[model samples]
Target: MGGEAVQTDITTEHIERLITAAGSHGVTGAIKELGVARTGSIVIDELVFRCEPPRNRHAVPVRIDLVHGTEKAVHVLRLADGEPVTSSEEAPEDACVRLEFDLAELVTLVYGVPRERSAGVHRSELLLAAWPRLTAAYGISDHELMGSVQRAVDSVLGGLSHRRPSLNELAVRYGSDKWSVIHWFTPHYDRHLRDLRNEPVRVLEIGIGGYAEADSGGESLQMWKRYFPRGLVLGVDIVEKHGLDAARLRTVRGDQSDRAFLASIAEQHGPFDVIIDDGSHVNEHVLATFDALFPHLRSGGFYVVEDLWTAYCPGFGGDDENLDNPGTSLGLLKGIIDRIHHEERDGADPDHVARNTVGLHVYHNIAFIQKGVNAEGRIPAWIPRSSDEINPR
Candidate 1:
């Protein structure tokens, strides 16, 4: 033989250990071995890896620079060699050749590295079959590995004042156009709902749209589903939305103003972490739904009323001049503010309002009610009996 090809020795055990540790420290654990070198030159004429669905929206393309030793004959896995793609327009210019993996998929594949492979195999059909076959072959028996990799990527992307994607990003990702729903609404949602981003929550959104047609609505429902990857999104509308049903998403036809019907929906699929009234925009319907459902919200859950401006318009049930209409949804929400400060009144009854109304946030056309027992202890006002007692700290 004129020349011999050096075999690149790699093993599943080493890759698995590296990934396992990366869970705790994020992708930083694997960066030392896998990160692209500061200098661009490399001697190895070997495989290059490029991953997609990058950790951040503004993510630069990442590469690994591996240096294989001729003496050891071991294959070195390095970051891909390329300038980081900084802009969104540049990312998909050549989307076809790029190997994209979500956090779990990449970790699972890394854990199944085979021993002593050729560079040719890496370039062949092996990469295409790697995900399922490798995952099935070596198998990540420990569930922790999957979770670690997911957290690792998220943590790495979310570090050093790098915020997670905003609702606008989710909207763009899922094509929801939630921003058009209300200009200021999505940011407020991101602020309040940040903690529940990754939770396996049950979300109920009222008003599935579609009008009288069975194939019509559920735009916001789709948005909610995409935003909460682990969430179950359910919608209730008066119109039958037979076409919108899918895995993790379900819709029911019902009347928002009917207390019994509303109660039944809750009974069947409630105790929800988030509930949004995006339905009729009718004042009576809004008040009726809140009274029926607010009591059922889980502790620390959120209840959002979108389109509150409808409360001041007669079509939905309000007088533009009189906000004091007891029958109007706006009036009903205003009363809750009184209840929030109920303890401040001289003869206030502690049990008059639900003790769990922790906070109420009002915006241009939205109202966010936070549910939890108001844990702040209060002291009743007392006239000082003596001068020394008046200044008591």
Candidate 2:
């Protein structure tokens, strides 16, 4: 099945073009025609695609069919006047078309990443280009056809400009297109991760979901797994998650905020190349995990903490308006900033954190701590000699 191809009337490229130009319905219809359904609704609007032989074409009744999970299903019902039947059943005498699809293909149809500048082509232009074939398939008077297709195109494009490239195009492709899920952080992530896409690295993510349920978490882990192909993905949560472990993926249940438990994790499964804390966003918990895990990160590795806005909330640690509370994660990170320049100020012996932290990047509600010893030693203390003074000497 890996190298096998599935047959369809439209080329996959054309289907993709339809999807990018026409919208979700284009994807649903194209994928359905390819037998690629899995849990979603397929809407057939008769008025839009009028059938031939005027008797069968009077504002065809709109039908909305629900497709369940992946199973090579196709309903070969007459688009004119027949009910859907299973793949095993013999199609009725007047069956017009067969439609079906599976989960994986549906995901691809909805979330497929296109090449640069490929998705912004004008929908009207696409419709205009395909007009002759579409008109032959659906009997519509040429005089009235443009208006009908223009309305349909407008419905599909959703007011999104499709004529130019956008800065957030990659984010649109990979992050928000698949589900209702929204992770606004993907664009920022793309900046740092573009080069590491093919590397075989270990990524440690803390906080698996499914609150109070043993096997509920791992969505982020799943995303990471797909994004990193060859990389190993490990997840840790406070609850026991079963049935999620598989090749290149491992899960452990432990309190990431606990120093000893965090240390044990490092010894057992870490010294990680990248560590992400999406765990308990409680200020103390964040500080605790960072303190315990930052030292264990491999040199030149990255340590990231998300959801720092919780540090300003009462339940997590500080007063809503306070940004300087020493007890909050943000406050603790401010302390780390001071540590970065400890050599120039009169202070207690520079903390190991100050010595090893080579870069501290603070962004809105997130922080990235890069670990490495500063190989570029301090600039030689400046002392300029005046020419006259040197000559007199």
Candidate 3:
């Protein structure tokens, strides 16, 4: 599994292969592919995993190394008693415990569907000889040190579980507005997205909140990352949001209304499994973005539009008086209904939107458009076109 150079950019395809190998080929096969620099790079990124809080007050440092061939990336997690776990890429001089894992195994543990776990799969080393040095350096008793170590191990191991929190819980934890804040959209999202939870999906969300603030938004992106363990979550905002980029999460600065920019991103990062329009709630922006990105959505994937209440707000180019105005978001959806049934009508050529939209689920202020082949041949063209023709005979 060793390689000559380190892989810098880990693509969605690489992750998919690693997941497939982990499930079908077992540890040896998965590890062999993971040994490549690119795969190893993703496994080593500290941001790819999340650690739980420690129970004790003693600061216990633990080291985890994802090893592939001759290459190894060292990661250290510091669990301070009663504090959140902190991670770093630097290897510690001496840690209370050091865990060594095959690069592929670690990836499987963190991102594999249902998460891979078995008895005696990876290696764990307890640095017993360093205990005295650590105790002396931190001025703690053996009892405290042991307690801290237990808590540290528990915290780290807890994070590697395949079980995920509910979408509402994640939304609240990640500070996303999709929940109780203004909209009760998480439940709807969970219903539509539960099937894709374990998939190695590419999710693109337009409108990274916290306008213009580099580090402010991306709560939903983080939520998506946690919910879809193997997913690559990406966000787009009009402002520069490079601050939010991390392992499996990327941010691009571009206007959602700009078709060219949307097309460019879709070309580079698409055939996306899920594309959400949470950006500017303007009716025009929503319609334009849908036009630009819908084609890039993979078949059977979902395209979500949030905050449809904007369709009635005059400030956002909506007409409360005339809801059927085709320019509004709701108006667009109304038209899609016809497009989806174009085959049933005379002289109706199924356009791109109609041909690809197999299902549409509209909720309170959100809608989920399901992409699939809409060619369920209309009534075999021989079924009675009118009740009068059949009854007259």
Q: What TM-score would each prediction reach against the true structure?
A: 0.58, 0.53, 0.86
lDDT of 3 by residue, 52-87 (tens): 546757777788777777777776767775454555
The models' CA-based lDDT, in order, is 0.56, 0.53, 0.79
By TM-score, rank the candidates, best first: 3, 1, 2
* Tens digit per residue, CA lDDT, model 2, 1-393: 000112224332343343342333345455445453322222111111112112232112111222434343333222221222112123322222122333334333333332233442321122244445545666776544555433333322221222322225432422322123434565555555555554555789888776788766666665665455335678998888755664456788888777999999889777787898888888888888888888888777778888888887898775577678778888988888877776655554776788888888877777778778854554445633457655776
Best by lDDT: 3
**Candidate 1 Cα errors over 4 Å, as ranges:** 1-165, 173-177, 350-353, 383-393
Q: Name the TM-score of candidate 2.
A: 0.53
Q: CA lDDT of 144 in candidate 3?
A: 77
RMSD of candidate 1 to true structure, Å: 15.7
* Residue 31 shift from truth in candidate 2, angstroms: 38
